[model samples]
Target: MDETLREQQLRMTRFIRDPHANLPPPGIEARRLAVYRQLFLGNVQGLLAGSFPVLRATLANDLWQSLVEDFYACHRCRTPLFTEVAGEWVGYLESREDLPGWVAELAHYEWIETVLLLSDSTDPAHEPEGDLFNGVPLLSSLAMPLAYVWPVSQIGPGHVPQKAPGEPTLLLARRGADQKVYFSRLAPLAYALLVSLREQQISGREHLETLAELAGMEWDVLEPQATALLLDLKAQGVVLGTYSG
Candidate 1:
């Protein structure tokens, strides 16, 4: 709380954030400061690398390191837990304008796996064979519906597409009973229905009827397809069960 101590603390943090730009606080040996700086920065870099493995592989060593440095120096994390660091990194990426178009989407695709793995909630017990039309479909606690401009799931070392496809990518990722996260590509209509199920507490029949009306299709045409899709999702553990009452 002393004036001199406060100034020293500020200088030390600045040095930790950007050691090349700012010198260590007065009377601290450069060797001692270098060790602290390397230890902290290296740990962050390693964590980011572990969190976004495919992103790191796509960008290669130098570009990935530069991106990590920028993230470290610019972002002030809200939570102290290391498990939440990837979310902070994703938020930081969202704010940056100079990153490649697919970078943020790719980072998010990688982050969701960690999010599901660490989630404390479990899927509600429901009959896997429940009817979707007559029942209220319950989504898995660990499942998430994600729509992205780029085909983030397909991007990696050898298959980075420079431009987004004509249609936006739709994906459903869920953690199964085996505790493994799996991703499934979804049709745009199917993705919309899944998102609607999450956002609106409507019966599966009503949800598909609304979607059919919005798309100018009759219930007879959409119902069978929607029912089949829901059944597949239920089998996949994305949709646990449905409530008819």
Candidate 2:
């Protein structure tokens, strides 16, 4: 590329990113550049708005606009696909310190909905059969465990916490057979068990046994409670089926 054209391209991008701060290149009319600026910025803002509607609502207009401008000017998105913009935005929020403490958690809480909605992956090998206790419990492919300190699942227009709790809020978001995504609040132990089931790929009984040992409880006492929890999870479709492996 020619030196002048390269400089023009850089300047054009800079202007588009922060039109309020940077003037358009010398030859280009300010009016035409303003149009381009709006078109570019508006599209990004609209996409992010759709992705994180609650976060946008929680912040005042000026704060939201400044946040979006900062994102546009500073963040270099990893993916080229437009649909992946939300993921990129979440990544950007992970590194920022100026925004509210809940911003990153809330952003990820919102982004997971989009991810589960768009997922096409399936667990066709597992037949929805066998006893959950003896057979290996297969976690729902669509199930995602999120541990956040700010109680992000509870945050919205009505409620926004100023500080994170001492203990993390564990949530499980799962897509059911009906294709609706549901959010379930998990007790710390339940959350750990589900994570262990997924990570260890073991039998439900074994998972619960380990949990019981870790908690210094007798297996007989924990067994009944563990069985009840498993049954509830199965009913909710968060536990898809049992795998014998």
lDDT by residue for model 1 (31-102), tens:
988898889999998899899999989996887888789888888899999999999999998888888789
- Candidate 2: residue pairs that collide: none
lDDT of 2 by residue, 6-61 (tens): 99999998988877788788888888988998899899999999889999898789
| TM of each candidate vs. truth | 0.91, 0.91
The Cα local distance difference test for each model comes to 0.86, 0.86
Tell me, what's the RMSD of every candidate? 2.2, 2.0
Q: What is the total number of backbone clashes in candidate 1?
A: 0
Decoy 1 TM-score against native: 0.91
Q: List the residue pairs that clash in candidate 1.
A: none
Residue 175, candidate 2: alpha-carbon lDDT: 81
Which stretches in model 1 have alpha-carbon errors above 4 Å? 1-3, 122-131, 243-245
Consecutive 10-residue window with the lowest summed lDDT within model 1: 122-131
